[model samples]
Target chain A: MAVRLYAASVLALDDCLLSVMDIPGVLDALVMDHLSGTVMASGGRGEAERSAPALGETLRVTMDALAGATHRGTVRIDDLIVIADDGYHLLHPVEMPFDGPLVIYVRLDLGRANLALARHQLSSITGRLRG
Target chain B: MAAVHTLLTGLAREHATGSLNVPPAGKAYLREGRIAHLECPRTPSVERLLTAHGRAGGYSRAELEFCVAGAVLDAAYFLLPAELPAARPKFRPGECPRPDTRLEFELAWLVGECARRRAQLAQIWSSAELDDVPVTPAARLPGHRATVSALEWEILLSSDRVATPAELADRLGQPAYSVLLAVRRLAAAGLLVAPLMPRRRGRALDRAVPPALPQSDPNVLAAVKRALEELE
Candidate 1:
């Protein structure tokens, strides 16, 4: 599976601590950890080298606060799809088979991709990666 | 305690399918005598973990009652007695759609995971000094690994210098044993600091400081004095 290649790329990339390739590349691809909100890798960081760890910390705080506000005691990610000025950002967490829960993240350009197609592709990618 | 333990063990041996309530402590549901579900107030329940993981939602009182009944019957099938009894009784509870097989499997898996996690926590909690040692985040862990699970991250962040494994588990809504395992693993990996010795209870008394002992040579004179004192 091409997605498998992406997974391998993410794991393989020295700069990219984690990767989720072959996402519906509306803009580019992003690799994020759903739990920590850490951006382990990215394909397009045009004009900005955003701090991945900081972003991850922000996501964790946001999730925690949201859970607290809702009195849910836990936060479950349904799907994190956000439209930005440059492109579309999609966060898909891939569940690993082992004990350590790992997730794969992907980002893409809005003009270059279809939301439905990208989501479907990501879903398939996640399923294959998990299996 | 011996009698109760024996009874539970017997149920396990015979593969008796039923719910054994330990009054306020909790309940254990056995299917064909193998433990399928267990609830101990001291440990987080499987339902809580599933809900926390976003796999399931909190159940209403009625829904919980229904689930408890359903769980027992489903476990029975998995625990099908090696030898069928002479009279096979009919299941009375109006057949709810056979519980989603996948969900049932997941539930069982989660239950087992919780039990394992709880046992690990109990071991950590047993240590005297560590019993109340507050979990404090280590300033540094010797790892370059980029990403970890939410619970793992929480364990890293919330080890606030005092919360024990059980306390940390409660705070994070995770199985205590999981936190204990993570802590132990982190400690082994040189990620977390070892627990410090507990403070003495009595007040300090002023005394003349003793000279440092020589590293290379034994204190023959001091040893002779100690031996002479013992003999006298």
Candidate 2:
């Protein structure tokens, strides 16, 4: 049988604080500003000291670099998914009506979570939060 | 043109699938006749959204492709039916490569949330200057906590008398709908002028330009004439 995973969604009313809390082995979730790299919201351990504003700045730099590399004039990323040794990092961009680009980020345990299942769950979470 | 509102209603009824390109404006991708994803040239793409958030990283080209393929399907699943009125039957495709019922449910939920946010923003804009009124910024608004979105701030600071919401969207690289929403919101917040009646073409411009200075002030006119005669 394939490994199964659970998913949850969090809605942060404030800027970058959406909480997709407690999805089985999933550790944390956050919303960040892509243009400024500011972390709007987050849940779980080790996220206490994360500077949202700093992160937002980093994202802008990253975007600049990516655009330069691709020669695509200008580029904005929709989502970012990363698989590290310890966990999987999923970033989903939520395009707000009146704001610069915004996104939700989630980190999940690799050993205990299913990547496909998590992605599906995140997609739903995004729909609910944005819709 | 029939107008976007009318077109959307027609498309909603037809349940049409495929990408609808609005020429130089943008495109909406639909599946089985429902809007699955929308891409306005002025707004960021889905991939850009993800990378900007710091989620997926350090993947080879193959891995990126694999994830994107899955995301496209995931986005389609979430977006299509959500846009349809609740009265309609929600259809699910039979053959998904990776079958995960829970995943499907979650995707739907996220899409709905995003759509709702979009709607809220739209409501805010609709109440403002983007409507039939002349596009003018407001003098003030209430609340110390009145946080403006980036786009909103840009619109507020950059708007001159000439540019409408759609024109601003093009200049600022934002979605036209989003710009319209922001403009409306500004109006509702009393940060914009009420919509004005359509002007008579060039008349508005003519009025806007400063009239040439009077040939002379009433007193100066006679004095100037006398001085000219003496010089002659």
Candidate 3:
């Protein structure tokens, strides 16, 4: 009701963010444009926002490097993971048909987060977000 | 910007609240004079700060304020005035918009942010001709040697030529700002036939894009620096 009054159209992608937030161990999550690193939407802590610039650049550089290294015209990445002593940081690249690839990144506490479940949920969120 | 925008900005600066309606453009919603919301039927809502200025967690309060500030400022640049011939587009004493809803907010920060964003957009691609123009993908990959980002690839594949960036954004359910950036980047890359003049009419709000948030622990100080830097 408030949504109709406030925002003519309430953002639906926010649902996707909420779904990811419900996953256990997920501390922070954000989605950024793959090319310009523009923040699209997010939930959790948003600790990953600043890294968006570097993250988007990393996606570009890595895509180029991998394509060249493997000698392929196109290269597809499933996801990128960084393991830390304190927690786990995951970057999932979504092949959204609209703006190309938007990266959905999440940070998880190593102690509280189940890597398998978290990855599974992240993948699920990405799929649902695109559909 | 248009005259209706100036009138609307004045209402915001004076701490007035309501919806400043523009016949053909869009509406600006002010909360206690601080622009609380914006509605342009033809343009995508900067619903969540999706500008090219920053990158960060999109869920923090302060960050959210910054996002709000950006949305207000960016809209002012395009809608708050008739045309910005002077380098600095400020809110001079003039006509403003009369809105139906009102809230409380200081417009000082909003004013400054507008200037900053204006300078920033100029630095990005330095042209607005293509900003509102309809865009179409190139016939074939030029030289077939173009190096593009993932987002660019998506935009290229989706460009049907008839859709403007705003329309494309609506179709893809992506932020209009990101689509705006993608269009600029693609044009800069020489991958599109720009000057495809024609502003798309208003679209229904069936598929609205999502907002931006950052990923961090809830226990931190909200490292405002990271988010601001990416956007600033």
Provide i-RMS per model in Å: 15.7, 12.9, 10.9
What tens-digit string does per-residue lDDT give for candidate 3 at A2-79? 101112112334555667777898777775546435454566545565566676666667777777677676788887
TM-score of chain A of each: 0.62, 0.68, 0.80
Query: Sort by TM-score, best first: what order?
Result: 3, 1, 2
Cα lDDT tens digits for candidate 2, B109-182:
33443455455555445443254334677556654434454566788877766665644544553444446666
Error of 2 at B17 (Å): 6.7
| Candidate lDDT values, in order | 0.42, 0.46, 0.54
iRMSD, model 2, in Å: 12.9
> What fraction of the true interface does each of the listed models get right, in terms of native contacts kept?
0.00, 0.05, 0.12
Q: How well does chain B match by TM-score in each candidate? A: 0.45, 0.39, 0.56
Candidate 2 lDDT tens digits, A18-130: 32554656776665544323333456674622644444445545665666677445566765676878588776776553244556677788888887877777667656544
In terms of TM-score, how similar is model 1 to the real structure?
A: 0.36
> What DockQ does every candidate get?
0.04, 0.07, 0.07
Cα misplacement distance, residue B200 of candidate 1 (Å): 11
Provide the lowest-lDDT 10-residue window in model 2 chain B: B96-105
Q: Specify the highest-lDDT model's number.
A: 3
lDDT of 1 by residue, B1-232 (tens): 1323334466667656656554333454545544444554444433333233332332222223222322332222212212222343232222222121111112233333334334544443433233335555556656663334355667878776755655565555454444655665455445556446432321111111212222221343333223222321
Candidate 1 chain B: minimum summed lDDT over ten consecutive residues — where? B202-211
Which residue runs does candidate 1 get wrong by more than 4 Å?
A: A1-131, B1-9, B22-26, B50-132, B139-150, B194-232
lDDT, candidate 1, at B106: 25
